[model samples]
Target chain A: MPNCDKVTALVSASLDHSLPLHKRLAVRLHFLICVWCQRYLTQVRFLREAVREHPERLESAESPSSTALSPGARERIGQALRDDRR
Target chain B: MAGNLSDPQTWLEQHGDYLYRCAMLRVRDATVAEEMVQETFLAALQAKDRFAGQSSERSWLVGIMKHKVVDHFRKSVREQPVSDVELMNDEFTGLFDKDGHWKIETTGPKEWMDPSSALDKAQFWQVLRRCLDGLPPRTSRVFALREIDDMPSEEICAAMKLTKSNLWVMLHRARTHLRSCLEQNYQGLTT
Candidate 1:
């Protein structure tokens, strides 16, 4: 039986659609036995659905290019064009 | 028009940007990456006859760029300090039991975690890149080739001259470091 901490995270991950098959079954079994984990899983499911249903913020924690490159890096690419020409 | 080797400058002009971009993506440093790109172009110009087109020109440049990045990191960054958290190698294996059962609970039959959202967060991406930077040079090289560059595991094994176990160990270490880093970043905040 997974304890509270592991159960909470598993529920969170499950709500996020991240739990793998075997682990998913184990979490389901635990949820059946433990009401706290079940509620936690419910909250997670609700929040994830809310997040999905709503339009995400432009700066939400999910953008690949959000980690902006240092300023001028893209502009600096033009330097390569000029330098290689000579 | 493309077969001539006497005009090395023309070849450099034609493909220099491609070479530099390949090196930059691998090394993540603009200045040193630029030097490596120049060297790759020079080397290719000298040995253009060796190009048998086993891969596309972009991929060939990437192969050469890989070697250059590895060589540069080995020569320079390998001696830097690696944190104790990152030094933990076998802990991620704790997720598996002696019988190969997964210890973590999963709610669904998902095989992969979509960390794309995690990457979207600027703070998370910063932490992730820092964690990657902390990996041992060779391990980071292999990990970057597989994860960031999207190279096949077999290609990484061949390119890095590592065994399958070695590859998995390196990847495990990379993930462990990144996960712990992200967890630490998340632990203090109420998000």
Candidate 2:
């Protein structure tokens, strides 16, 4: 039986791609007796889904004053655009 | 000509903030994100003649920004020496014991109750942003590209010039760190 350490790594990898049969079986067997590993899987899967579904949450959650484009950058880009036009 | 493309003069006033925030979320750097938004605008201006208005102009610019972000990634990977030391570090090894089981005392996974509901909480997103910021720059970039951009593994491999296995390792490390960070930080908020 794969230990929790190995099982957890496989659990993370399983998110990226399907595990080969033997590795898949190993993870499943470990999960049967391991609540911690089970919780790990659930939490990571939740994290992935949360990030994938609502990425805007992070943007909105960010402090606007910090992440927003500065006036200087805006002017620089505008000037570049105008220069391109001419 | 038939499309509803906005004038280039108005792009900064209109879409600048939105585009900057979008790039900031992905790139996690103010200067680079600003540069990306700018590049996207310039590219859009050059290609404005081709805008078929299939999507909103904002979405069209966002599409171009995505390419810019990916191009930034590709360039960074090219410029930096591809080192495996960071990827092989395995920071979580201490969480496991000699027998490969979780230590269960100091570093085992904690049970988070109703994690899905945390997604609705603004504090949760803040904690997530901090956690992502805590990751190694390259690892976080790879994670953002894969998770946020929804880029496929093969495309990520090609862009970063990483083998599939390397990409998997970096992503696994990123997810592991973020999961633990969220469980520790966000779990505190619920209690």
lDDT of 2 by residue, B65-170 (tens): 9899999878876635446555646667767888988878767787776777777888899888888877776788889888877899999988888888888888
Scoring each candidate complex against the real one, what DockQ results?
0.06, 0.65
The segments of candidate 1 whose C-alpha lies over 4 angstroms from its true place after superposition are A1-86, B1-34, B40-117, B186-190
DockQ of 1: 0.06
lDDT of each: 0.51, 0.81
* Steric overlap count per candidate: 6, 0
User: Which clashing pairs does model 2 show?
Assistant: none
TM-score per candidate? 0.42, 0.86
**Strongest candidate by DockQ:** 2
How well is each residue in A1-86 modelled by candidate 2, as lDDT tens digits?
A: 88887788899888889889999988888888998899889888887888889876865566533456788998898898899889
